[model samples]
Target: MKTVLITGATGFVGSHVLEAFMAQADPMLRVIAACRDRRKLLPGFAGEVREGDLRDADYRKIMVEGVDVLCNAVAWSSLWGHVADSRHLFLEPNLALIDAARAAGVRRFVNTSTTSAAAPEHSSDPQSEGIPRPLWPHLCNVVKIEAALRTAASADFQVINLRLGIFAGRRYALGVLPILVPRLKTHLVPWVAGGRTSLPIIDGRDIGAAFVCAVAAQGLADYEGFNIVGPEVPRVRDVITYLHDDYGLPKPHFSVPFAVAYPFAWLMEKLDPIVPWEPLVTRSIVHLMEEVGVDNAKAERLLGYRPAYAWRAAIHAQMQEMAVRQTRAMSMAMPIV
Candidate 1:
């Protein structure tokens, strides 16, 4: 049987991926869950649970042992500052895992990434290197991780990078809805570029399916990158309008171009140190709002991916979760230790 290890199998992305893999019920495959806290994992998750920290070199090595495929969904994300943490906490361990997995003779390595990692000039291509913004250091590290993995791909070792879209759905943690919705209630957020830019929101369930397809895909080369998105891409206006009409969340009172928005976001980041609370907005958030011309054509053709979830349905699902769990505005950073 082919052993497959899923790191952070309890997280937003990891949970969905884990669920999809179990749904397949392939007799030839053995699913192994690798996480720091197995207790947080979803109920009815009947898999070989390997509990340990990804940071531990010993644990990383042990997890990949005898594993033919390793899907790395672990992430330490921060919307705003914390450059040092972004590297040490998030980037470094992921790099170490790639090396460890490759050394352990893992046949396939799947990674979680965002479409924003692609350069604006080459927005359509998920494999393209993105422009690194100085304000958002985490994004720079994301690009670096991609480069490192791409370099590791050889005839013997395969790497699949799934450039996922804005996340929304079950186990929804920090994301567009969780972050932006509360701020919208403050009546502070404005429609950047008249809310025209496409919000490439993809549900967590579809994200899981994408990873499953990537794992099972055939005729794939040593290194493959695909833009994984929802069934349809919606505009910022369309999403916000629905939130206002359906969910009764306040909409942006005014509009600003990307020019004004970027600087405003920068100023907010600069003020974060003096302010007792998190910044109302950040450059990274603004960066995400910018046009990313991502589509599922490449993924569909290559991975046989067909996204079924729509944007509105995903947003509603997220709002429902946020209503119960989010008692306060979400912090800028996600630190898992």
Candidate 2:
């Protein structure tokens, strides 16, 4: 039987990945989930669960032992924490995990990366091609991680990096949407460049399926990269408008050009520490707005990844889930007779 171990199995993306593996009816596949907290493991999960920080050498040894494949989904995510924190909290741990996986004789290692790594200059075509420029600090760190993985991969071990697009759907805790939602409630978000920039988005479920494909794929190079995105690319204006309309909230009326908005976002990021809450805007968010489009064709051709949801359908599903949760919350809050 082939054994697959997933790190960050309790996190937003990781949880979905875990579910995908669990749903697999393959009796020959043994799935294990690793996270810091066992209590967070999915309800009714029957597989082996290992709880501990991957940074600990002993814990990593236990997690990788006899594992045929390793799916790394953990990240110390903070839109405000720029390069320094990213390197310290995210880059270091993940790179170390890669080395450990390689040494442990893991046949394949799958990593979760972001499409923003192809920033400063993006392509409109359906190909995974771009130059890495230091436009966004978070993506810069991802680029560094990708380079490290490439260097570490060998003929005996394979590394596959899936550069995922902006994520949405239930359990999505990071990305611009979570930050933008609250501001949108108060109509505080501005229409940067009339919000016409193409926002490449994918459902969390699709992302999980992509990971599953990576694990099962064959004849792949020792080191390879693929762009993972939704079937349809929606403009920012459409997404924002859909959110407002779905929730009966006011839409943003104000607008700003990229040149003007970028500086303002930089200033907001500078003042984030004292603000106590997340900044209404950040330089990283601004850089994301400049992305034209993402190509998922590479993933389709290479991994046979076929996304089931488009941006519109994904957003609608998320809003419906949110409404159900709100109704349940209100029911719980009502005073009993």
Candidate 3:
């Protein structure tokens, strides 16, 4: 029986990955859920659940015992506020996890990374491979985690840093999609500019499947940085249009040049460095207006990673799910006639 240890087992992606592994793997596989709070974990986790902070040496030592694989999904997923903890919020805990995993004799390690680290081709920065600065602290953790994994003393543990594109599905962060959906339905969220930026979206559930595949793979010498993107790319404009069509709302009014959006992004970034707890729009989102499509051929060939949902279908599915939720809410709110 394989023993798999998962960090961030309570988070959006982490929760799904835990479930996915349970479904695909043998019932005998020993799964350990290592998280900051075990009570926050999803209902009916079929394996051992351990409470531990990723940053603590003792926590690592306790959780990694007899664990053959480690999956890192822990992160600061806030949108704004808490600029002071940027370093600790991302780098410290992530670095600690990588170091501890190597020392613990874990055979395989899979780390979650977001696509925000990739620079657009038009970016003026000279260092293409080098991680760009001024990144959202959560996303920056991916880069730092990857670098740390590379430098870890050549141990038997093989690391796979899964660089994920925008992911949506059950329990996802109410990112651009959720925010835009309600606004577009009410005609509040505008397209702003042309909404020309192409978005590479991957289903949150499919991301779960990807992690399962990573765990199932026999060896990991060739498995490294792979961009997990949707099977097809969808422009932001089309996404908004689909929302308008789905909800039968008036087409969103457009204004505010793309250039103007940058300053709002700048202010949002300045106000919220680690996670934008409160902001009209944050830097990570501002960059959303910019193109972020990625090639997933490597992931396809390596991990047999294929998105289970299409971009448009996935977008509509999200809106549909939200609609069902709203309907339930409305039904519950009615005067019990």
Candidate 4:
């Protein structure tokens, strides 16, 4: 049996990936879930579980042993920290994992990345190639990670990088939506450039399918990258309006031009040390909103990846799940008569 070691198996994205692999019913595949908290793992997951920080050398050493494929879905970031902090928090540890995987003779390594790695400033055609801009911390790190993946690829090993679109699902806890939803309810979020820009969003379940495809893809080059996105490309306005209409929340009534918003975001970031929570907006977020639609054709052709959910349907599902959770919470809080 081939052993696949999945790091960050407890996170939103990682959990979905784990679910996909387990559901495959591949008798020849043995999955090993490596995460800090095993309790957070998906229910009824009958797989090998290893618990520890990936940064710990001993932990990584043990996790990579006898592993054929290493699927990395781990991510680390702070709402109010220097962009350079990403080097220590993300890049360093992941690079270490690559080394460990190589030393342990892992046959394949799959990395989960963001489509924003190829923002407009970096590439006119993100599907073919992307030049990472150094302005944003996340983009810069993705560039470095891609470079590392290329360098690590050899005759014996293969690398697959899935550049994923903005994640949309009930399990999604990070990114723009989670930050903006509550603010929109209070009428605190603003429309950037009248919210006309296209926002590429993919359901987490589809992302999981993409990871499984990456693992099973055959005749692939030593190094390959694919842009993973949803079936429909929705405008920023449509997303905000959907939230407002579906949940009866206040929509953004005002607009902020990029020029004005970027400076304000920079200033807020500067004041991050004293700020209690993340700023309402940031330059990176603005840049992401400005991106054009992502092309998933390459993924479809290469990995046979056909997205199963439309943006509207995915958002509706998330809203319904959120409502159900809220109702359950309220019901539990009420005193039993």
Candidate 5:
């Protein structure tokens, strides 16, 4: 049996990966978790939990020992703000984790990443060099993480980076949908570029399945990357229209080109100190509106990844969860910093 250690087991990506690993019910696989709080793990999860913070050197060192594969689903996200904190809280720690995994004899490392990491013009290139955005520091750090993995990969230590599209589904609160849907309710959100760009949203279940494929797939290179998106990439207009018609959410009342939207967003960010709440819009959100012409062809050929859920179903699942939870609007930064 090949031992797989899943970091961030209590998180959205990590939880789904754990579920996929367990649902397989294969005698050839042995799964465990590394999370700070074992109590937060999914119900019916009877696997071993190596509980501790990744920032701790000892914990990072101990977690990957004797593991055949390390699925590093742990992620720190912020759509805008918190530039300085990212290096210490996210980038440095993830880099340390990668170092630990390599030193502990782990043969394979699977990393979590996003599609927007690349420049909008070069997004179609699955493994293109990531272009940094000053408006979104955490996103810029994601690019740095990818570069680190590429440098870390070797003949023995194989690294697989999953460049996932926008996240949707249950057990998560911070994403485009949770932020956008609430903003739409205010009836102030406008269509950037007339809502014509593609939104490559993917279901949490599909995200899990892709990881399963990467973990088991053979004949992969030492450093591998794939763009894993939904089966169908929906237009922004179609998604907002569906919400307006079915869920009673409001659609964008007007349209603005990218040139106008970026400046407006910058002004909102400038008003941060005086405003009682977070900015209604920001440049990072506008960045998400850019056309990311990504597809699933590469993932299908290499990892045997096939996304099963549609955009509507994924949105519906998140909307339902937000109703029960999400007491307040999720900010672009975690811990409000």
Candidate 6:
């Protein structure tokens, strides 16, 4: 049996990755899920669950056991934190995990990266550039990890870095969708400099499937980095409008200029350092209004990868999940009058 170790096995993408392996029902597969909190390890897995911090000195002792494959899915994805703290959150833990995995003689290593690592300098294609792009704080950490993994790549262990775009599915962060829906339905949202920025999106299900493909492939086979994203690109404003039409919500109302809305977004960020409960018009998201699409043809030709779900279908699924949650929330809360 081949043993596969998954880090961040309890997070949004990690959860799906775990489920994908379970659904396969492969007898030769033994999954070892590594998570920081034992309490977050949900039921229904036939494999072993190890609880430990990835940055710990003893991580190798705890996780790098008889493993053939190691998935680097752990990350501190918050928008705000001290730079030093952020670096520690991403750099140290990831670096330690990579060292441990290599030490364990893991035959294959998969590192999940973000497309934000590469910034677009200029682009004629509106879908490609000329927008305010948010400087992803964790991007440096990803690059550092990538560099370390590349240096360690030898005949002993093969490494593949999967640079993923904005992922959507049931467990998504629900960051931009709230702003999109309200704007599309009620037409009451302000435009972030005309909202022309194109954001690349990939369904989490497709990302999960890609991991399975990676495992099946077992080696890089002449490929190193792959951008895991959808074929078609959509602008931020259009995404909201599409959701409005799909959910039968009120059409969006774009009134104020994006620059005008920037202060409110700043205020929201100041008030809520954590992810905003609603989408705030910010410079980073404003850049998303410009093109942030990826070139995913590499994954297609090499891994035979394809997006399992279309962007519209992904949105519809999210809408359904949101409705269910809202209904449950309303049911639980009695009228305060």
- Tell me which of candidates 3 and 5 scores higher on lDDT: 5
What lDDT tens digits, residue by residue, belong to model 3 across residues 1-337? 8888888888767888898887776776788888887787888775788896666778777878888888888756534434446456566877877767777788888888766666555222211232644545544555566677755625476777777777777765535565544445555445656777777777777888888888887645733667777778787777666756766756758656667876766775577546624444555666666665566777778788877778876666666677666442111011100
lDDT of 4 by residue, 84-146 (tens): 566766788899999999999999999988777767654334334456654476567777887
- Candidate 5, residue 73: the lDDT equals 88
Clashing pairs in 1: none
Question: What's the candidate order when arranged by decreasing TM-score?
Answer: 1, 5, 4, 2, 3, 6
Error of 5 at 98 (Å): 0.8
For model 1, residues 22-124, the per-residue Cα lDDT tens digits are 8888898899988889898888788799999888999988889999989999978988888889988889999999999989999999999998887456768
Query: What would the per-residue lDDT of candidate 6 be over residues 194-292, giving only the tens digit for each residue?
Result: 656666777778878878777777345522777777767677667756765666766445545555665666665566556534333444454345454
lDDT of each: 0.89, 0.77, 0.67, 0.78, 0.89, 0.65
CA lDDT for candidate 1: 0.89
The TM-score of predicted model 2 comes to 0.88
Clash totals for all models, in order? 0, 0, 6, 0, 0, 14
* TM-score pick, better of 2 and 3: 2
Write out the backbone clash pairs for model 4: none
Local error of candidate 2 at residue 133 (angstroms): 6.5
Worst 10 residues of 1 by lDDT: 118-127
Clash count, candidate 1: 0
Global Cα RMSD, each model: 1.0, 5.5, 6.2, 5.3, 1.4, 6.3
